[model samples]
Target chain A: MSAPMDKPESSRRQFFNGTVRGAFLFLLGAATTLLFRRSQPKRTVWQIDPYKCICCTNCATKCVMHPSAVKCVQVYPMCGYCKLCTGYFEPEPISLDTGAENQLCPTGAIKRRQLEDPYYEYNIDEPLCIGCAKCVKGCVLFGNGSFFLQVRHDRCVNCDECAIAIACPSQAFQRVPADKPYLFKNREHQA
Target chain B: MRRMLRACLYLTLLSLPLVAAFGVERFPPPEFDAGYKMPVTTMPPARALWLSYVDVAVLVAALALASYLVLKKRSRDGVLALSVFSLLYFGFYQQGCVCSIGSVQDVALALFNSGYVVPLTTVAFFLLPLLFTLFFGRTFCSGVCPMGAMQDLVLLKPVKVPAWLEHALGTLPFVYLGAGILFAATGSLFIICEYDPFVALYRRTGSFGMLALGAAFLIVGIFVGRPYCRFLCPYGALLSLVSRFSKWGVTLSPTDCIHCQICDTACPYGAIADPMLKDPHPDPRKRARRRLALLALTALLVVLGGWLGERLSVPFSNSHATVSLAEQIAAEDAGKIKEPTDASKAFRQTGQPVEELYAEAHRVRGRFAVGSVLFGAFVGLVFGLTLISVSEPHERNVYDPDPADCVSCGRCYVYCPKEIVRVKRIQGKNVIPLTPVRGEQKG
Candidate 1:
């Protein structure tokens, strides 16, 4: 029978073997250490970067949730506060009235109120909003892009694999730290 | 066995038309109705968090079972049963989400982006298999992994890859691993998950390209034996590295090897290394000199690889949305283009200054430049090591399993005479003692 045990190693060869094994151990330890060091206490949630979002309407249908968790949020600081707000009004509204036909939001989710002379404020009704991004598209196309879509944590089921994120045409969906969830687009920075 | 072969042949014949039917479009055109009402989009009842917990429990249990079967039981049938169970549960039932293989990218991206927090479960998924491999060799690869299981099931005729070609092609997984990390770290893409061949089958819907690629991999798997796992799986490459330093590895026989050569033929992955023979050679000093020369050449290759990587970064960076946008804007500014893409139009509508966009793109490109060079250096190192290893001679005394290649499939157990003898002894049957041959040893 062949030798059941390995041949006796010379001291130099033994040293070489030890060194190689040591190197491998060192690398494995380093990787594991680095991974643990980088790990966070809490996981992040899906979010949308408004600047990267092209106002695609897939948010309305791609989600398994009816009337998707994706909701339009407004950054008030960036709002121009225009009387004829493109986001609130249709392309060819009969008048600047808050009628369902005159409004760009198909669900009449945007509540228009006269804040001041030639200025109006629009608030989104979360229950009614369908996340079509029609108003977002309008605002981005003609206004200061104050209107944007965001994943509402309360409404979101936190699917391990978010369907909207997968079907997102522009790949706007990303993970954000739960503590500071929203990826709000500030005037000073790009997404 | 002949009856089983006949049954398989009949099954194949019966399924032939069904296979051809996938190509034909059978749906008729929908007729319009004026009174047609839009179907109300109802939410499917959300799966409970408990269900997700259950999936994790199932995964852990299956992994434990697979390890036990491979290390203790050493039963091929047990391994095959576990593989089928894993395939059904993980691949078909769970629809292939939150996979350990894909979690590699998530971990990589999280490591680079401090702001991005990878899920705790994802971290568990990524590390569990690796830790298992470190202790028990590749028990995870034996049957636990759905991707491996899927490929293993379709292995009809596994042909041994030519030694030279196998050595050369083996480096691809390392390159793929490097590229996967570089892209994920730079926030460019997730090539590993994105190019996953089997995920589409699990999900039941995907791009035509991915579906075709999946079909192709399966067809090649019939003869090539888990092509993706062998040549393209980044996670497999990582597992192989850890398995190299595993505390324990697979043994072919229960008692002693009779050198029957049956187990060698049984291993589908070609992971069995024969007992070593003494080399009749002279000039040890010359061999050392040649190894030194190869080491120097390896260093030179690394430098060249890093340089080439940096040089190609500009075009490579275009895969990033911001970089592509900047290029388009630059072209537009120079009056070289007139058309505006949907993204470009959206960018314009956002009213962000073009300078800021360019700056972000430039930063992203700079990150890619650094990442790609590192990626190239990593690939070069792997290539050099592969080159060195292929020529390295082994002095193994017994016909042992190659730690880096063996998946602990347990097929060897079926053909081992010692294993058969042990089983017969357990069953209380008459057995014959056979002496192992020494002179008939190959090499």
Candidate 2:
């Protein structure tokens, strides 16, 4: 306790022990390499964020792999198809045929569900939806901002770097504070 | 074999002049001419680089490498080695989520905003991947892109794209490609930008629709890696054709495979087309029916894609195009505030009336929906054909080379065991790099 340099272990023994430690480090490195020949690091990614989305549909169109990186998910309770659906078509549709020739959604994503004889509900086909937001633009510009876009975190890499973020024109994309990231629609914004 | 090699050499030599002279370059207008009269379609500069030299070099390199790797006759590791590297380049570097070809679609669509197509780069970008896709499977998806790369990286586990769904969804991208191109050609519209998910996601900064779409894909990719490429990438569909005849691809070592599912676990991409399906494509009557159906579908789509392209095109360029009253107000306000810059005036002088161009906003809405359905139908047809006529799946355990998507990232070379052998090439030996690994070592 009195002498800091003094120890039960001898200096020669300590040096040899250090050499052995170095040898172990080398072995550990080699062994680890062989064991993990095909191993890669795992990263935590997200499903998406709802806030900050301006309802552009790049998800549907931009995905390189096909089908796309984007898919439309439903928040069914929020849908209300006014005669003028900003997310569905231009403010004034020529006719209400529900034909592809009339609607705003590129992939026939916004399916019109009849709630009653007059009141119809618009629904998005998550599979077919590319999130290009032709409908959203139409909706926001003319009718209620019911339909919006989101960054599905699940599909996102949460990359230490994000590719889409760099290319975003609106600078709408942002990193969610890692703890709790899903920014759903605000109560007032829903209207 | 020697003759083929010589022919390749000759092709490379022949293409050199074309590349140097034609590679994408901005040439000054004719010295004597003060006129704005320019060629409607100048030779796409990049085409020279791509068609002549780079493509030739890539093809030669890929073929030679494939032969050498095949001769290794070692573990399924060989396939994984190359596959992983290609996946990195295509998926990561290229930001696989955004389709460059589709950007042409977007650029074409920006007619509403008076964006003339940014030529040379646009055409070359669109066509290069397509050209590659014809012979190689959508290898662009596996390695040389970012969307697929993101999925590949994010995937904790991978599954195969379901047969029916895969077949149906797969046809969509081609329809998109064809229609997108057609619309661009017609100078009518580009719906690609109109429906860009990433752009929207980026613009709005946050999203519900885009998030949902991204989430769904992530989930799908987790279950089935490269879900977009196998079932949805329009470019992938195009590239699949090119990759079909690819000289070398990720093939398993038949003898070494031992039906040990380890490689299956190791290979993130569900590319190991089960040998059961890999049996040589079969049957005459069924095949004939398929051929007939394909021809019919192709005809239907070509007409449909063309008509849709035309219809879509009219919205931005047609003088009689519909414009919403609100848009008219916005546009009028914009025109007033804009003060007709010299560039815009010049732009107007080169082409049609500015007001006429502005009047087509109404058509933008219709083009998207119609374009989607038509494109979806086409995708369905393509996938249906693939499902029915499945053969030469990644039965062998080595990676296949795809020019369309390959960015030439060397991740797989590093991971490959035999890459350590240092295979020789006449020019010089390509040394394989080491693989990158995550945090604490497992051992």
Candidate 3:
């Protein structure tokens, strides 16, 4: 009788241990969830910048993904929409050629259509525009602020917070109203 | 008790509108724009150096102390050390605003996404757990977790669960782990960040329901034990698997475990495996069967979750995609609301685009719903599967003894049935054990 009693007692202890382990786990999750829920002002998880951008030719090179999400943008109102835009190609072309080779953009993103016999129209094909910003640099340096780089929020994932904001070299990125996100600045650069 | 807390937590959450009702009449509601950015941001070399030194020193010592205390014989001193270390860890986890698993998941997912990369501080957070876990058992859930601390304090008594429920719930965390990775990988969601309930508990301004939930959990934890860890957390689920396969961990002594449930009763976190009558080896066939069963279960959960997340995300997903607005409107001579609502509403600076505003609103709701469901499913699975799987833990001498998954929670170490203690050695540096010092009681 005593020997059999020992066996029952051992199993009972084992049973208790198993149950405790289970309950411990259940509470761990509950506790973690509750604790993490403590008050926090909404945290902005993502951000981006625009100022320190050099319009380097490397957006095409640095990106690991195909068709780099980065693309060149133009402020149409600020654009001269030049008929003979130097930003599109060399200022003095030997001949007015629209051939891919002669075109200023390596990716053929720039489409120089004839707006008029004298004033040709230049537009960007964003699908091909690699934010290399070569055109932006050219336009900004010589012409009106027609060409610039702006992030297409539509293409951005915008995590609960923004990651780009932390990585941006320039401090140009600002948190616009979430309801009406982009606070586009068509106005000239301020000193 | 748990039911009461849940009611409170939910009620509190439901009262968010009330809180908002009292919000200031500013243009951009403070809720929308005013918040601390992830502190892991802005970290550079000097800050890194200081943080690393402090973090390493503190974590190592804590880890050692926790292990020593947990494995020591049940003395008054040992118990006190155990409680303090565990609470301190919980406090630290609360202050940091993110746990190791969540932090790691965030950083890893960020790195995997081509769209962006998490800050280097995220890297530090992710790695800390693994380093400590190498020497100690899951210290994160036991000691360094604010959530654990809360439960530890509240559990006046513990309850017993049936083995069947434990088994069913045991599988949820893994499902959560796999799902979290997949969703995070696909850039569909950062699930970990969206649904952390404890963050609400710490701030004390959480919805009353959540506060009640917190309170309930604390009370229930005493009777039932580490319910949160065992049942609800996807991250904990991940750690359990990692620890299961660990090469080293807490183990039993080579003596008779005098058939006493004292450790079982005393363990606030409930991580003890009785030394006596435990099988040295788990039935291989049973384990294989469970593994196979889990694979099928995980597949079903991930697919269902992914589809549900996508369906829920449809409205916000399209509008939120980044496109250069300035360029799109380059030809416009004047600007007007793309979508119409009064621009006078909170945060809608006079000329803001209504479409963006609507999109943002949808974004928050969509994420909340998706996150809540996924997290809910995860919680359900952890508890259900664990209950079902509950068994006389095999007399395996050691627990998961690996660098990953342990989180150095120190439970395995402290509750180890072992009589022989491993005295850890650190050279040229004073390492803080993940465990607490037994004698020092802090007010």
| Strongest candidate by TM-score | 1
What's the candidate order when arranged by decreasing lDDT? 1, 3, 2
* Predicted candidate 3 versus true structure: per-residue lDDT over B109-223, tens digit per residue: 5544544444333444455554444334455554555565566556566665654565555565566565566455444445554455454455544445545766766666778
Question: Ranking by DockQ, best first?
Answer: 1, 3, 2
DockQ of 3: 0.02
Q: Taking the tens digit of each residue's C-alpha lDDT, what string does model 1 give over A1-191?
A: 11123334467865665565566667656766777777655656778888678776888877645678788876665666556667898887898898888999989998887653545666778789989999987776655677788888776656444667756656688876665667775555521
DockQ of each: 0.05, 0.01, 0.02
Candidate 3 chain B minimal-lDDT segment of 10 residues: B38-47
User: For each candidate, how many residue pairs have backbone atoms clashing (under 3 Å)?
Assistant: 0, 105, 143
Which of the predicted structures, 1 or 2, would earn the higher TM-score when compared with the native?
Answer: 1
| lDDT winner, 1 or 2 | 1
Q: In terms of lDDT, which candidate is stronger, 1 or 3?
A: 1
Better of 1 and 2 by DockQ: 1
Off by over 4 Å in 3: A1-191, B1-57, B71-94, B178-191, B206-213, B258-443
Query: Model 1 over residues B1-443: C-alpha lDDT tens digits?
Result: 53354335434544454322101111111232344322222222333445656777887888788888887777789999999988888888776767888888888887788865566667767877877777678888877888899999999988878778777878888899888888777776677877889987876666666678899999999999789988888999998887776756687552356677767766778788866566433479877887898798789889888988888788888877788888888888898999876567657666789999999999999999998898888877888888777666676655668889898888876666666666677679856435432221221
Candidate 1 pairs with clashing backbones: none
Write model 2 residue lDDT over B1-443, tens digit each, in one string. Answer: 53354335434543454221101111111122233222121111111223223433443344334333433332334444554554443333323323453644533333323433233333334444444333333444433344555566556655545555654565566666766654543344444543433333333233456556666776777777656555555556545555544433343333233453433334444334434534343676776776677767666655664465445533433321123322444554577544543223323334555555454554554554464445445544554455545422333333322223332222333333333323323127564333422111111
